[model samples]
Target: MPRNQWKPFQSITVQWISLLLVCLVALPVANASEPKATDIVVRAKSKDAKFIGSSMGGAMVRIRDAESGEILAEGLTEGSTGNTDLIMQQPHRRHQSIAEGAAAFRTSLMLSEPVFVTVEVLAPYIKKQARVAAQTQVWLVPGKHLDGEGLVVEIPGLVVDVLSPQTHRYTQMADAPFPIRANVVMMCGCPISEGGLWDGSQMEVAALVKKDGRDFATIPLALEDVNTFGGELQPDGPGLYQLLVYAYDPRTGNTGVDQVSFIVR
Candidate 1:
């Protein structure tokens, strides 16, 4: 072949080699950007108690992208509240697995890179008035497994439900003393009782009364049974009476309230 013909062939050969090199160099980078399945476990824990689980109607969990507001995973925790001794009685040490058999919401996220995510939990799903929401933010690294105790969000506050002097009740003034009753429990649905794990005796339960929107009186409730508190309200004169019943634990600073209104004829 002539030298000019040979030059054209050389240029074509070099172009082909350049293209091949570019593809080879880009392969690893493209693979690195591919999404990875990352496992995560999330648990909703009642403050000073155990996990919020099936007995309490489980807890709803939502994992979302912190910046984008996109939801990554959504579900409810399943299983038990956890072992009473392990979660409450035993003293926790560093790296202790308190959630070995506890309830959890487990899911895998497809992540190409690290993500800042927000984990939100709404607990005791069945109890609308007593339900509480808690959330936390964390950076999730691709391929990292958040197992073991995983991400635990503590939920504080008690669950208070007014059981007597029901909402919109019409009472006769002849029934001078109106009976008041309430049920109080931990956020995990743990029973509160005198001399029990969660002692009702240590908590103060009361009913704050208001007549026609005016401050009436405060009546202290005594523990009547497990998780139950009862008292009587002696109305001075019958009108529209509102009752706000509350339970407070001085030691743990856990408190909850429930209210009801009734008309006396």
Candidate 2:
């Protein structure tokens, strides 16, 4: 073959080699931008107390993409409520983890770049009336783990359950001054007692009564036993009576309520 002919073929071959090298160099960069799995942890905690755990029915957790409003993960938190002394009594330092082995909802998201997410939690899941919802937003980075006491959503409220003067009860006016009883506890199901932790003596509990849909008496209930508050409700005449029982902690601004109805003959 002629030398000039060989020169042209060599130039064409060099151009193809250059293009191949460019593609090889760009491959890693493209791969780096692809989606990756990111780990996230979320927990629901009672205000001024422990985590919301299995005992009270673990909290429901939902993770959504902030920008798109797409759900990323949905599940319930599982495990214990955590150590009482560590979560409630001890002072916490920066970066201290109180959620070790505590209840949490864990999930992974596929993300290529940093993404903003909204985490919503409904705690004390079994108690519909006492359930509290909380939420928070965070930026998730690919490959980053939002673990170790992860994102804590604090729920503020008490669990109020009316115990006496049962719902839909029928009674005579003579029974008007009947006992009103209720059981109150922290949102985490922590017991409330007169002189113990989560003291009921420090809270205000009462029954707001209504007769035949009209304004009636407001009876203040006194702490009678562990998590129990009692009082008396007296109806003036024969009518439908409704009792709305409530508990409030003035110090923490936490409140909860439950209601019942009865008919007087």
Q: What's the TM-score of each model vs. the native?
A: 0.93, 0.93
Q: What is the C-alpha lDDT of each candidate?
A: 0.93, 0.91
Q: Which stretches of candidate 2 lie over 4 Å from their true place?
A: 1-10
Please provide, for model 1 over 154-186, each residue's C-alpha lDDT reduced to its tens digit, 9 standing for 90 to 100.
989999999999999998989978899999999
Best by lDDT: 1
Residue-pair clashes per prediction, in order, are: 0, 0
The prediction achieving the highest TM-score against the true structure is 1
Q: Give the C-alpha miss distance for residue 88 in model 1, angstroms.
A: 0.9
Report the lDDT tens digits of candidate 2 across residue range 24-60.
9999888878999988889998997789889889999
Give the RMSD in angstroms, all C-alphas superposed, for model 1. 1.8
The Cα RMSD of model 2 versus the native structure comes to 2.0
**Cα error of candidate 1 at position 76, Å:** 1.3
